[model samples]
Target chain A: MPYVTVKMLEGRTEEQKRDLCEKVTKAVSETTGAPEENVVVFIEEMSKNHYAVAGKRFSDQ
Target chain B: MPYVTVKMLEGRTEEQKRDLCEKVTKAVSETTGAPEENVVVFIEEMSKNHYAVAGKRFSDQ
Candidate 1:
């Protein structure tokens, strides 16, 4: 079982999340040969203060 | 690239998070032979309402 997680900023609407879950499930199923129903997709939202890039937090930038 | 993510229920303090990151980074580095600096660890905190088990959200339980 492959669990796909999408991590991004916390500004997406409910509809966007639903669409993302559906699309990611389909893609993962197609590529990995897993059943669409068995493909689990997790959405993780991070705040600017908790997210960092290039050794600097997004909030700091 | 071995990117490790820890997902759990929220409410941990900053100190706990810092310790977790340090430990996870060291563990991944030792096991994967990746340098400590090269190991990236991401902590994802999920709310009870958003988390589910056996088709029932934790909040619903």
Candidate 2:
């Protein structure tokens, strides 16, 4: 399976994030024909101060 | 740069998620000394019916 990383603003329940990981793992497993366990998913939560785009901070956008 | 994917239950401002993409891109660039433009990130949203783990559906868990 392909390595996956999820970046987002933090605020979701653990259950929701966990579900995401599972689903993504399954999708990669099915699409790539790789073992589910081999698929690695990384989650990163960003704060407003840490992200920027289009010459402005994400929180400001 | 490494390929990244973010999997989560849907419901975030586009700005918030876009900021995430930028931050992660920067982080990977800084850490690996890769070109920022070379990094790729994918975002996937999951529904309750699509994800499961630990012998239970994600929504059930």
Candidate 3:
């Protein structure tokens, strides 16, 4: 029942996302003792404008 | 790194998100002893079709 989410900037290819989901599911399942089939992975992509650091938006920098 | 994410249906206004970020940052900073500036919060919005529960997507229901 472990749901893992990977958040990063948008632009990865579909193949890379597929590989990431597979690898992350396997790693999470192995480490947390959850079944591979039960591990859920979510990918979140953020545009530069919506991201920030040190009180400054990425788009401003 | 205590990176916090809020995933939900995509309908909220920008003001609500701003409020959420502020409250979440304060709460996390207070509980985890991390400075407010160091606590990063990410908002993830999903359409109905992208969300699922009990193996059925919300759009299908």
Most lDDT-accurate candidate? 3
Q: How far is candidate 3 from the true structure (C-alpha RMSD, Å)?
A: 5.9
Segments of candidate 1 deviating more than 4 angstroms = A1-45, A48-61
Backbone clash total, candidate 2: 2
**For model 1, what is the alpha-carbon lDDT of residue B39?**
66
Sort candidate 3 into its docking category: incorrect
Please give the C-alpha DockQ score of model 1: 0.12
- Model 3's i-RMS, to one decimal, reads 3.1
**Interface RMSDs of all predictions?**
4.0, 12.1, 3.1
**Which has the greatest TM-score?**
3
| Per-model TM-score on C-alpha atoms | 0.53, 0.49, 0.57
Positional deviation of A46 in candidate 2, in angstroms? 0.7
C-alpha lDDT of all candidate models, in order: 0.75, 0.65, 0.79
lDDT tens string, model 2, B19-42? 656765665555444577877877
> Which residue pairs overlap in candidate 1's backbone?
none
* Interface C-alpha root-mean-square deviation of candidate 2: 12.1
